[model samples]
Target: MNRTTRLQQITVTLLSAGLLTLSGWGAAASPVQAAAASVAAPACGTGDHGLLQDLQKAHSGADSIPLSFSDVEFLNTNIGRAAGNGFLIGTSDGGCHFQKIYEGQWSFQQIDFPDNVHGWALAAVKDGQAKYLLRTADGGSTWTRLSNQAVTFERVEFLDSSQGFGYNRASTYYTKDGGESWSLIKTPANTRGAAFTSRSNGWAVVIVPGSGYRVMKTTDGGAAWKQVLKSSTSDPIYGQISANDSQVYALLYGDSGMSQTSYSLYGSSNSGGSWTRVIAQETAGGGPAPGSGAAVAKKGPASGTPGNMVLIGKTTAFLAGYQPAAEEVGVGLTKNNGRTWSNQKAVPGFEGVISFTDHNRGWLAARDLNSSTLYVTKDAGATWTARFSFETAGR
Candidate 1:
């Protein structure tokens, strides 16, 4: 998602979830005040062993300032997950430019067709509201416009350099020869999010009108899809899915005001053919009393809400979120697939979005003083180092 659209979604979600109070057209709480109360001290782990000191000694400090994408509204979705080789892509200035992070170094370059770039996918595919599609083969060094006619896509994903898919409310499009050619695929339902494990294996969360959310699977590329699971309640369930070689994991959240404001984690080893509830934890204001037949007790404040979740391995994952009532931001991890969780030490900032490329390397996007900063961690969720700061970059 583009930074602007993602921020708008966050504002709307926060308002709906009662995390932010709105008086007229303004927020009652300032970003700085909220951030001041939310930051948590780092929880350095056993292997930490002066990793921060080592980083300082090796790089002399984190990457220098004047970083790309530091001027515009920043969102956690701005940074893409790290590829197998540790190639990471991020947007700057709302997708007008690109930021490449490789080998612990950061570099920036402008997109060839910079107008209205709303979303991007791996293997360098860029699309936007203007119906334009562009691709870059040699990283961001050069870009090629791929579409002659107009097309609108809200999300795009590429499993590899040769295959990709893009979609919106109206239609789904796919390409095999990189982004050079495109074709249409019939969608099972209106999809909110989509991810592919391979060229022919993928999953999508479909909004089934008044029914609820349905997890769909596709094995013949995009030619067909089958419903793997349908929510049992009328309450809306928003889901984010991640997949590895043999299993698919879904982190789900119900409606904001439901009596039981709990979140669920489900895993399927057979490509969404069947699912097992891995973890279900009640939120602060909803569900049964702790240890009174509940599987997992609430850990954060009474009004804490769930945020982004990433599965780095079959049995390991991380979740980031905050408790608006207490102005506390927290991160948690589940080593045994979510059956049990341990809250990491607080890190003193509103955790917005988190992305993990592997078991121990990840990045977090946080908001403070109405600006965004990026933090990187090489030791799981232990110690984090500030990699990019908007304020410092601007100076």
Candidate 2:
């Protein structure tokens, strides 16, 4: 374990017990910095640590970050997960340019695409009733509006090459041909997330009016649905969804009070038939073994896919590998029923939002405050590889 984690444990121990050995918040840590243990270089492709060091020195303590389709998919897993081998790792050789800022349209928040080369980006207008969903192909060089009219879109989820799900005003929209076409489904409110074990068997978690959150299961690929679990307690947040072919985890967060909230994570073992509550506070390490009881250890093939990710709270962590203690910030880890997170590392440049494809496979798609380029580490946090140097970077 690194010194940061050790100090964090001491900190949490004191705080949770309602006792303080110190008198200031100077010891507080962000999860982004604490989760990562190292700062190694990126693997594969064409980037290096020396390059990153050169850029870091050039900027005098700034950060740079990047993202392709896969990176975006991982960060947006609340609505989706990896379909196969790697994230949609397709991009033009040069670079993709974000659309120009519209006066009150096209902000690039909601995104959906049927095929690899074409997609849509939705943004709520700054002071208008109409929102924009910018469509792109040829590697994001430019975008165009899909419609002149604006509707109540809150979140967007693409199911496949020709189908997807989107939400507005707590109602679900089903598309047989991407966002080009859409149909309304009977959702009670905005859906927290949607996932599928097989192409035909999928599940969703939605906010029910006056009753917190609930789960929806569909055996025929969401053609129809059934309610499995509904919380009598708190509602689900918008960004806590994860699943593989066999299992899924739907995470929800809402505090009843300042001091009475648990980590509040839930898992679905038998597809979506039942749901089990996991943690209420931040937990770390990998996720659980498939079909294994809490009393037994499971050895399924997918467990190695970084089982559960790790989490970083305001303070306290328990891992190691790279970087310095002071550069620490936020954290990103699994929140399942286990304690051995794999890619438990601090995402360079970005803070607070982190997601992994599996234990060893993770990525950060957020931008840095100092630069516009992207940083990546294939070996967790041991090192970093800088892409696009000699340009604007970020924090």
Candidate 3:
């Protein structure tokens, strides 16, 4: 049998058994429909402090801060917005060129839209100085600063115009009046990430201190939570979760044994009720090859960091992470619901955020320490064309 067939067979067998152990070989806004299949499914991820530092450096020596996009959202084949490092830019003719919509000192770390007409942005000043929330109603063509509160959240997601969640590593807050004000929501301590399908359903990534990480679910908004998935003390879970309606995705990491660290992908079709091992234990040294059931890992890959995952629908998802096999950042695509995955184009970065409007077209914002590059793919994830590097956008 071919490697893909064999790996699919192994996945089915392991999934039927319950949890796929660390052995060998490794959101919200439902109310708003996607604008087009040729665009992305809104924005659904965040950057880390390292990214913020990169933004700070890029902001310091230039007359205009470059388009170091922390997050990107494409509403259609020809309309999109990219935000980061004191600026928000939009394009009316695909991504060929962009015009600035908003610029300031606070870097925009995340942006979310319930629909093409309603959106939100989360920003924080360099050096941990302050935080601000902004809103846009004309498809990001213009933005209005909503509030300049003491909000420490690094990410934001809106289920609709007036309901959304803003969370960080410490706590989560909910806003019902279009970012006007927020109320502290009691979540598990150290809630690192959160995503919601509606005003009433949500999931969170919580750190378990002495143990590991947890994937928790809540039916009544964020008032209560139940443990749906947990990691072992040795193989801790990463702090990023993405959910849309009843489908969810979470990450678990293997022990970083000095040389390399591995990761596994878990998927749930019924919210966070149960999970199946989509990708099995994949080590840095001796793991199976890409289409042979294991996702690749880099040597000494950052501990507690998992690859970025963006779900396109119920059956299609994209995985972006380090691919030591090729010594470049790689993209993996699964059309048969992770029964199999094909490693797609390799981009020039160690980390990336993927956005897909559907199975055919997508965009990737790939970043290294010195620059962030944008790429567009027309044939799903098979091939990519460099559109522009954010490091040189305004130069």
Candidate maximizing lDDT: 3
- C-alpha local distance difference test of each model: 0.48, 0.38, 0.60
Per-residue lDDT tens digits for candidate 1, residues 137-249, read 43333334566664566545554455666655446677778667778765566676666655677777776655666788888977888888765445544566767665676
Rank the models by TM-score, top first.
3, 1, 2
Q: Where does model 1 exceed 4 Å of error?
A: 1-133, 148-151, 167-172, 207-211, 222-224, 257-263, 279-309, 322-330, 346-351, 392-395
Give me the displacement of residue 202 in model 1, in angstroms. Answer: 2.2
Put down candidate 2 lDDT per residue, 280-368, tens digits, no spaces. 33212322211112421222111111112223221212122121222222233333433422233344342222333333333334334
How do all models score by TM-score? 0.57, 0.52, 0.70
C-alpha lDDT of residue 302 in model 2: 15
Q: Relative to the unseen true structure, what is the Cα RMSD of model 2?
A: 17.1
Model 3 alpha-carbon drift over 4 Å, by segment: 1-67, 103-106, 125-129, 207-211, 235-238, 253-261, 280-307, 323-327, 368-371, 390-395
- Residues 150-173 of candidate 3 have per-residue lDDT tens digits of 667777777667877787766777
